[model samples]
Target chain A: MKTVSPFLELESGPRVKVILDDVALSLPQGANLAAALLAAGVPVFRDTPISGAPRGPFCMMGACFDCLIEIEGTTRQACMIEVTDGLEITRIHHDEALA
Target chain B: MTRSDLAIIGAGPAGMAAAAQAAELGLCVTVLDEQPRAGGQIYRDVDRVAPLRGDILGAEYTYGATLTASLKHSAITHLAGAIVWAIEDQFRISYTRDGRGAQLDADHVLLATGALERPMPLPGWTLPGVMTAGAGQILLKQSGVLARDAVLVGSGPLLYLIAAQMVRAGTPPKAMIETQTRSDFISAAQHMGGALRGWRYLAKGLKMLASITRAGVPRYTSATDIAVQGTDKAEAVSFISNGHTQRITCDTVFLHHGVVPNVQAARSLGIAHTWDAAQQCFVPKRDEWGQSDKEGVFIAGDSAGIGGAKAAEYAGTLAALQIAFAAERLTREDRDRCAAKLRAKLAHEQAARPFLDAAYPPYAQALLPDDSTVICRCEEITAGDIRGYAKLGCIGPNQTKAFGRAGMGPCQGRYCGLSVTALLADARGQTPDETGYYRIRPPLKPVTLSELAGMEVTTPDAVH
Candidate 1:
């Protein structure tokens, strides 16, 4: 698959395939999850539970919760998480579902 | 429970310096951080990234490798990838690591959590294509990613540094939309004497500007009324510069003004804070030793205030010296002697701050955005909502939680606390100090219930 990322990588290494929101993306291992997704061209991380507005990585650091995603039934900051192979990631939706 | 002489939270410049210093002073120190590696945002992934992109990031960033190297000591334990959630009573630190919760009991606690980019809450700022320049830098550092045709927005020394870095990376931004004007320079001119004393910083800024100029990127200075123009994502940046309205087409918009201390963890401990008028943010109150108003708790580095990375290391060492004296590892004379030169160096590093703060003051409108702009990204609370809350007798940020869940979202007001205070203060005719910040609630950074419940409560003290 061709990379649709608007982001360019200075270096690329081993590829690891992960499923994000039911779509498979071959991302670079050892990359921060948020950056890896952007490098893979995965659109928005999750829609705002309040207004259903699209939000992605804003602060990249842990301070902002803009890039919230779910992996293995646990919701976490995509910026904080690492890129690992065979991971199943889902977009977090609904205020009550935030974990 | 893990017991240590001092539990330092964060592995950034301050935390690394403190841990190394305290360890050399014979204190058992354990440092924790959310990242899997040492070096906070300023130097994230220095061990890996520096070896590759050191020239692009510049020596200032790769210098973090020295701090990381100093942490190699037997007396210091680094708990990497630990997301600290709370600082409980009696210096008990609660955190999660690898899907499990844990606690650390320490004789003293040092917070060096560092700063967050002040949110520029304009319309369409929350769009996917809009991110802080800090975040963009993080992508470059951690993943070697660069955005295509990004427009750099706002003012600060950091904007120049990143623009230079991007130029070196072969992806110079479309244009620079800076807010600092002639009047800003005129206001900052009063501190020229002090700024001259901080010549190194000025020299570095000039070098970055030279690099950007060499790259031939268009610059729109004295820009005002800037907004991210897009229906769903940032397609362009529209602003007024030099008395003319203009728009620059771009795929990404990087926003920044300045950074304020990330004070949620420190504030949660009931640490007394004071408003810094020049910086326009509330910072934890601490003495020369970096000890907060609360007993046995110290806030070093940007967590205390926005001292640069070098100053942060000195501040951390000073805090460690104080802790060593308190721990009976160092005599009063020894502590003072060790900290004397450090305090002077820290002051020298910080001498540029007054001029920089005056030169790039936070945008007035963004602080208390006009009615329609969203102030709290977590709750989608508009600026008008906060104004309405003040009219309805909402005196402080805490009231917003009840009025509209402004600070009750998952982020716990890390991004919106200052804006809420500013808006309420504007509407009620009160100072930011009088308006007051939110009462921070813990689990500071979202801990899973299972992790908390599954945490092992070992014997009170398990000294390794």
Candidate 2:
């Protein structure tokens, strides 16, 4: 997959490593987790339970809840969560019942 | 428990201005916002993003820097990362910050939640890679990322603004599919005199359109029946333009129509709202000073109506002045003298709204999507399901919600409320107002039960 980083990354920002579905990836420490994942070519953040359809962040400003995932055993909006080192995130499975 | 003379929800232009003014008037102010920064959506991450991104975000965005800085220096208690979930009677607010529940009581509360992009529910809108234009702009603003090979769809000034912003960032979209027709321009022309009073806005719009054209993005005007085509991701967009079928392959599709007041907090608080025919959305009823029907509550900024940032700032100032007068901190004469200039500026700022509303009405076809198109992305409900409920004598959105669970998702009808109302109205052959909207209840945003249980309750008088 090709990376689609649209803007130039500032050199001085803090860099951190986080685990995405057991894959370790480094991103800017304070960047939006969803944007970081998308820049790293991780589309299809979660699948709709009813239709098993793929959905990603839509409104990005917390209005749309499409970019939901399991983070530290709790479902959180990926767009709303900031990237932090050692953060553990798991892609929400379509068949997994929402809490 | 905490107490204040005024509690302002949201840290946008309106809330920031209101808090600053109220604090200067000898009132204790507390401002709560969900975002990690003070600037609301319009100026999200301005304190951090502006210096690094600079010209890419443009001057209008950098203006938020001064507002955020002033807010930081003010006497107001600013709570970033605070999610206000409930506001009880007697001005009690329950919110969570840093995963701990807290409560605050205020003599008055100001709602400045601001606006959201009008729901555009065309076929395949729920697919991955299909997103609102505002979402794309947020990505650029917050994380310095943009969708690659994106095709812009729908109509309104925001469409052009995002397109121009992308061009400035050196990642111009593949093309634009506009839904407004020649008649819309003609309708807007009648309001030219009033619009000219806000000449700066008109000039800004012209400059953005010129930038889009100069970028050489292919534009299809009067586009209708627009739909994104994909199996699991957005692959292409199909539409009818100029009496001909058109299809464009793209990696991403961004849609926009206009914006409507984020009335969730207001509606949950039982604030009276009336439909604004020009803007074609429900707005909270407020007086000149931003007082709602519910005493001790105020609605300001675009949340009261769809005025832009400048109008929101002026409205915030006016509302604070009124709160000051109510607190007996200023004489009536002094309040009037302070509000005179703000009132004049607000009038000029809002003069162009009617023209903009007429020029970029939500695409009618987009509102009433085809039967197979999904209306509620959260519940996976389709247009056909809503229409079926309507045909079965569903009286309004609330009834439809009961029957089909269309608005009972995690998004809490924020994404589907307007479309559901319009679809029901079209089916019932009644006006949207007559069809009515979802009866919003609180816990306006999701809250953990643990957080709620942790809240400390205090008597109103005891806190004061």
Candidate 3:
């Protein structure tokens, strides 16, 4: 599946390489990290502990916790965090890390 | 510890307006927000994103640029990337910024935290690709990225606005499955005169609809029994339209059903709230000047109710003017004169809300997901689980929380508060209000113990 929509690439900005789950991808600096990851075709930010059902960013605002991911050893809302060069992001599988 | 005459909770239109007006009136103002930038969700990243993306965000968004510029130029201290965890008695605020805990005392506090999209829980809504329409717009606004192979579900002006934005970006949704029934239009017709009084809003909606229509995006109206079907991720969306089952293949499914005021902060402060049946949500009770039942506290903007950005600004200005008068910075006549124009503008801005609210009433049935559907995403609680608790004599959301940890998640009842209330109400055969909402507690947002321990404390008399 093509993750990055072609429309967004129409105008380029400063690019920064961030490692997501050890896979490095170049995204526009200061762009929302969750959006950058989603555009990069990396879905399923976390899995439900009970059902292990995949979940990703829902409401990009802080209202919904669906976008929670592990960044810098702390789980944070990916949609709320801005992308920076060399930032390491890891997918969280359970809610325990968030607690 | 920091002290200011005025402390504003958000940096949206309301917060910015209050800060600007208060600062201009010679009050020491401090504004704290969770976002990295001052612009709240409505104008999220307006300073940086608007300049880069140009008019792709539409005209309403451009207005935010002026507000943000003013905020930047104001003497008020603005703290971005700060999460206010608690607002205690004596006008004390506890917040964490840059991994450090801090406390502040203010003579007056303004909550302009704003609104959240109404939770539209449906079958398969928990699927990975399904997200709120507002989220998709945020992606565009913050990063200039549009979801590919998307299908929009539910109904509201926001749904149309987002779809139109996508169309303008040359990445229109594959289809729009609107759940608005014929009755909504009938109810909306009754308020047409009031809506006409605010012709600009009606015109904007009409233009957005026309643009979406012109884009030739396939639209399915009166869509019912909508389901986002998927295994590992969203593969297709199925809905009944015109009494016929229709399915569309899409990776992204954006759902919207209007918005509700985010009353958590006010509720935590124990402010009075009244259920506005028109908007079908709990709104913090406030006076004309945005003063809540709690003295020295004000609820402005969508956090008070869903009056949009313009109304928020007017209300913020009114609140600041009132505060200024209270501080003896302005005489009675001066305060009244300043507020008079704002009051009129606010009335004009809110004139169309009733029509919009009636037209886009959250399809209540859709809100009550089937037994198998997940209601609380955090604890993985299903609708059936909540109903089971209700059957076991859970009378309200508070009791239901004890039976099952529904709202006790990282999001703190934000995702599931409404659903739990509605489900309990249905089970008890009572209105949602009778079932009651969860009692919000402080440490509103999660805070680490280390951060809390690091907080500076001062005696009450020291600040004075």
Q: Largest DockQ belongs to which candidate?
A: 1
Candidate 3 deviant stretches above 4 angstroms: A1-11, A95-99, B453-464
Candidate 2 lDDT over B1-464, as tens digits, reads: 77899999999999999998998888999999999998899999999899878688899998998888878645699999898888987688988888778899889999999999898899889988888998888888888887768999999988998999999988899999999999999999999988899888999999999998999989999999898999978889999999999999987889999989999999998988887888888998889899999999998999999998889999998999999999999899999999999999999998888889898888988778889989899998989999999889998999877897899989999999988988898899998778888999988878877776776666656745
* lDDT at B357, model 3: 85
Candidate 1, B38-113: lDDT as tens digits? 9999989999889898988888889899999999999999999999988987788989998899988999999999
**What local lDDT score does residue B23 receive in model 3, on the 0 to 100 scale?**
88
Off by over 4 Å in 2: A1-12, B453-464
Ranked by DockQ from best down, the candidates are 1, 2, 3
List clash counts for every candidate, in order: 0, 0, 0
Residues B1-464 of candidate 3 have per-residue lDDT tens digits of: 67899999999999999999988898989999999997899999888877776577888897898898878645699999999989987599989988778989999999999999898888888888889998888888877778768999988999999998898888889999998878888989999988999999899999999999999999898888888899978889998998999999988999899889998899999998877888888899899889999999998999999999999998899999999888889899999998888888988998898898888778665678889888888888889999999888888898877898899988889888988988888888998767779999988888877777887777767756
For model 1, name the residue pairs that clash: none
Models sorted by TM-score, best on top:
1, 2, 3
Estimate TM-scores for all models: 0.97, 0.96, 0.96
Go through the candidates in order and give each one's DockQ.
Answer: 0.81, 0.61, 0.60
Interface RMSD score of each model: 0.9, 2.3, 2.1
